[model samples]
Target chain A: MKTVIIKYNAGNVSSVSFALERIGINALISENAEEIKSADKIIFPGVGEAGSAMNYLRQNKLDEVIHSLTQPILGICLGMQLMCNYSEEGKTNCLGIFDQNVKLFPLSELKVPQVGWNTITDLKTNLFSGIIENEYQYLVHSYYVELSAYTIAQTNYGISFSSALNKNNFYGVQFHPERSGAAGQKILENFIKL
Target chain B: MLSKRIISCLDIKDGRTVKGVNFENIIDAGDPVELAIAYAQQGIDELVFLDITASNEKRKILVDLVSRISRQVNIPFTVGGGISSVEDVSVLLNSGADKVSINSAAVKDPGLLKKMAGQFGSQCIVVAIDTKFENNDWWVYINGGQINTGIKAVDWAKKITELGAGEILLTSMNNDGTKKGFAVNITKQISEAVNIPVIASGGAGTMQHFKEIFISGKADAALAASIFHYKEIEVLELKKYLKNNNLEIRI
Candidate 1:
């Protein structure tokens, strides 16, 4: 099966491609709309800031291309944040695919970036088919999507937030499944099988 | 809940895992990539590969090693050692390293942390501070804990966070190689002073040490090298022990 990872000006795309390689899937990293549209499955992987990322997506018109894709597509970390309706980070508007807004975690005793491992619970989508509840996932993000109707999985860091979102064929995860261990690999496998 | 992380650090010299006692009397451990895979399978929360290779080919060798680990291992890892510029950080991150830890380079030029964080978000930038307790307060050191920077550890931790560091790797020169436990006092000082997560490094002898660092030290993560390399304590056992102690670990 053909899987295309949408290439943009974001970081960590290489790791996702490498993670796919470990699972025996040689996905193509391309920014070409034609290659992305023709793929049987599309993966939108991202790291870095939301404002500049949106600027890059809009400049290359990949925003429109992503909105038009019907294949099973996965958005990861910053890619998942970009799929929301809006983000408090840089006050930028997002792709609005999940009907949710990404928010910066409130200033508290806890760290800002929320680096390291956190558990993902309330799994309700095929993206986490075999993954057990309270499974630890690697997360490093300050912004999170609030628990919404589209939230497929939830995690708490002082307060509960959406760790994963799903709508139709679109899937989004705030954690890096590529960086997470075996549980994360299983999630990727389930996503591929879908 | 966000779990306290247990990170296994590998000192890479010429692409081989090497362990030095207090930065001296080096001993070869094993292949870094193989050790990394084993650590990942042991359910370690994260890995940090400190590139201690002091050759001109350090960058190339470290990059290749990082790419290999990223392909074979399925856990988050941070790469550090002699990274000074934005170009170095870009090269390592582009090569699939999840994070780049800056130690002496960040001390030499504090602006490096701000610039790197602005260019590539704060989450990916980790500032490693090597400090030793002296004259009634802990002071910062550079050049692998040989040269004292005369700066207070607490003040430096706060400064780096303001400069856009998302995490702090607080290594206690006094506690390192002691195998007594972590420097809980200074670790708690830095952890409470900074808004970013603090990773307690240097001294770790038992699973109880991990528990103390997480609970009393208030550290977000704990990192160790020798105990893990020599198989003094199995990672899975340590994790299970920490979990049994109710430390909220990933086991």
Candidate 2:
């Protein structure tokens, strides 16, 4: 199976590729629209500010290509944020794969960039197949998307939010499955089969 | 719920883990990669690789090694030591390290912290401060603790966050390797002063020490080496102890 990881100006491109290789699948990392459109699976991984990353996507015309892909696409971290209708990060618009708005965690007592392992409770999709309920997944980000019709899982970090979302062929996880160990490996395996 | 973290640190010499590989009489602490895998399975919150003597050439091999390890380990891993430039941090992060800790470089040129934080978001930049209590105050030390910067440790900790550091790795020179306990006074001081997470390092002996560091020290996480490296304490047991005490922990 041909797996292509979109290589925009985002972090975790190498991480996404390496994660796939660990699961016995060699994925191609490229910004080329053709490779992304032709792949059996497309992984969009980002750990960056949305404004600049969106600029790269629009300038390279990769945004249009991503919108046209029909294969199973997975977005991790900021990649998932950009798949939303809009984002508070840099006040940028996103791909509308999931009709939701991304906003910054409230200026509350909890820390920004909640970096560590958090449990993804209230599972609702096969993306978590072979993974136990309340299994911990690694996450690192400041902005978050609240629960919506597309949200398949939930997590509480100061406030309850959509830990993972699904809209037909497009799926997004706020957590880093690649960085999440055995349960994460299982999630990747399930995604590949999907 | 955001839980407290237990981080296991591995010190490397040249590209090898500083275990039996270098010392004939010492116990083979096992391969660093294998040890890291064990920690992940044991539910250690994070893993830190510190190449104490990392040189230019050694860093290249370390990047390649990190790529291999990250695929298997799957936990948030941080690489530190000899990271003096944006390129160094980029290479390490590109090799699959989630974060890169900068030490003396941040002291020599404070601008590096902003540059690193800008290039790769603040979440990836960890500023490690090696501090010692002297003259009734904790002062920052550089050049592996040989020279003191004379910068007050608490002042430096606050400055790091202002300069865009996402976390601070505070290591007390006096308590490091002593196995007594953490410098709760200093750790709590810095933890309270900074909004970002403070990882208390140095002088961790018992499970109670970890608990004290978490509660008294007010540290979001605690890092230790000899205890975990020598197999004196297990990550699971420590987490259990912290959990029994009603502390939120990942298991």
Candidate 3:
């Protein structure tokens, strides 16, 4: 199966490719619209500001290619945030795949960007197959998608939020499945099998 | 709920692990990649590779090592030591390092932190601060704790946070290498001062110390080097102990 990782100006594409490699899949990292459109699976990975990322996608015409893709697509971290309708970060608009809005966590006792490992609960969809409920996943982000109908998994950090989202062929996870240990690897494996 | 992180630090020199690691299953303890995989298998939440190599070719070697570790290990790791400029951070992060920690360089030119945080988001930029308690205050130290900057640790932590640091890896010079325990007082103070996560380093001797740093120290994570290198406390056992103690630890 041909798996292509959508690489724009975002970070963490190499790490995601390596994770796919560990799972025995040599995924291609590409920004070319034709290359990404022709893949069996596409993984959208990002770890940078939303506005700039969106600008890069638009400038390279990747935004149109991504919105028109019909294959199983997975978005991780900032990529997941950009999958929503809008993001509070940089007041940028994103792909309307999930119809969710990304908002920053309110300043409180808990840290802004909830770094380190956090548990994902209420697991649903094939993306979490072979993964247990409340399994730990590594995450690093300041903004989060509020709990919505598309939320496949939930995690609490001041409030309940969508740790993983699924709508049709599109899958998005706020955590880094590539960086998450064995359970995370399993999620990636399941995504591939899907 | 977010679980407290347990990180293992490996000192790298010329692309090799400095402190000899003796894991029973490890074939080449000198190899940082092998050692990193071992630690990840033992359920280590994160790993930090402090590259202490001072050669002109250090960047190339360090980047190669980072790429190797990223390919082999399926966990987040930070590459630090001798990273001063945006170019250094760019190569390391692009090479698959999850985060890059800046120590003395950040202190020398605080603008570097802002520039790094702006270029590469704050989440990927970790500011490592080494401090010592003197004159009834925890003062920031640089150059691997060889020079005291005379700035208060708490003040510096708050400054860095405002300057766009995603996390603070606070190491207590007094507590480091002591193995007695972490400096809970200063750790709590700094953790409270900053809005970001504080990774308390130094003075972690026992599993109880880990529990203390989380409970009393309010440290979001705890880092130790020698004790883990010496095999005095295993990562899995320590996590189980912390879990039993009612800490939100990933086991």
Give candidate 1 regions above 4 Å deviation.
B20-29
Q: If both were scored by TM-score, which would come out higher, candidate 1 or candidate 3?
A: 3
TM-score of each: 0.97, 0.95, 0.99
Q: Which 10-residue window in model 1 chain B sums to the lowest lDDT?
A: B20-29
Candidate 3: segments with Cα more than 4 A from true spot = none
Per-residue C-alpha lDDT of model 3 across residues B131-223, encoded as one tens digit per residue: 999899999999988998989999999999999999999999998889899999999999888899999999999999999999999999999
Instruction: Tell me how candidate 3 scores on lDDT.
Output: 0.93
Q: For candidate 2, lDDT tens digit of each residue in B83-185? A: 8999998888888888999999999998989988887898899999999998999999988888999999999998888898989899999999899999899
lDDT of each: 0.90, 0.87, 0.93
- Each prediction's Cα RMSD? 2.8, 2.3, 0.8
* Regions of model 2 farther than 4 Å from truth: B20-30
Q: Could you report the DockQ of all the candidates, in the order they appear? A: 0.88, 0.68, 0.88
Preferred candidate (lDDT higher): 2 or 3: 3
Task: State how far residue A187 of model 3 sits from its true place (Å).
Answer: 0.8
Write one digit per residue (lDDT tens) for candidate 1, span A69-99. Answer: 9999999999999999898889999899988
